[model samples]
Target: MFKKFSPSTDISGQTPVKSSMQRAIRSSILSSWNIDAETLEAIWPKKESIIHVKCREHISIYTLHNEPLFFQHFDGPVYPTLRLLHKYPFILPHVGIDRGAIRFLLAGANMMCPGLTSKGGRLPPQDAALPAGTPVAIDAEGKEFAVGIGLTTIGTEEMKKINKDVAVESVTYVGDELWAVQKL
Candidate 1:
């Protein structure tokens, strides 16, 4: 979806997020993520209000001090920018892709099941299975930081069973246009 994202042409307006909405977001974030209060405050301070940066195609970027933290496409789950995921690695569940698939992912290709089900790839165990459409941090084999953020197209067990098709739909990656916009 962000294959050709150009901020200048895509952004429509910037507005200060309202306090009520801020509380809603704050609580929603707190409830949705596994982060502690201290960590959440450090990322989004109570004193600094979040800026709602509107873009084309119903994309809403939430920022603080001009640095993009997370974004939402339409009303979908909030996806932390790759930068944010790098800082607080445990906020979301993870799905790892093999080294061979890193190049394809960097090129903005959707992840196929083989890349994630192979020896190098990693997925949650059956006991910790995640449902479809869950937000996930995509890690690379032997990498400390996540390479991308995406939504699971199917359950982990399903991916293991059906290993030929797309597994995770890439939302944002390390070299995508969204990753380039660190500020504004």
Candidate 2:
């Protein structure tokens, strides 16, 4: 989504979020992700204010102190920015791809089932199976940090069974335009 993004042109305006909206966003994030109250507070303190960065393509990036924290595409699932994910690695579920697919992913390609079901790819076990449209962090094999953030196009088990076609749709990657914008 951020492949050709230009901050200067794409960003429409920046405004501080209302207190009521802040409470709603906090509650929404708390319920969707597996994070504790203390950790959330640490990332976004009660005193510090949040900025709503309106960009092209219906992208709404929420920032704390000018750093992009999370974003939403229309009303779809809220995604933690890659930087935010790096700081709080456990905020979202992880899916690993083999070294062979790293180059493709870096080019902003959607994750394929074969790459995920192969020897190098890793997916959550059936006990923790995730449904389609869930946000996830895409990790590279043997890498310590996630390379990208994406949403599941199909369930984890389905990816394993089908073993073909797209599994996850890439949203933001390491070298994408969004990552280049550290502060907004």
lDDT tens per residue, model 2, 1-184: 9998998999999999999989988998998887899999999998888999999989999998888999999988888999989999999999999999999999989999999999999999999999999999999999999999999999999999999999999999999999999988
At residue 5, candidate 2 shows an lDDT of 92
Error (Å) of candidate 1 at residue 23 is 1.3
Model 1 CA deviation exceeding 4 Å by range:
none
The global C-alpha lDDT for each of the candidates, from Candidate 1 onward, is 0.92, 0.94
Cα lDDT for residue 80, model 1? 82
How much does candidate 1 score in TM-score? 0.97
**Each model's RMSD to truth, in Å?**
1.0, 0.8
Model 1 residue 24 CA deviation (Å) reads 1.5
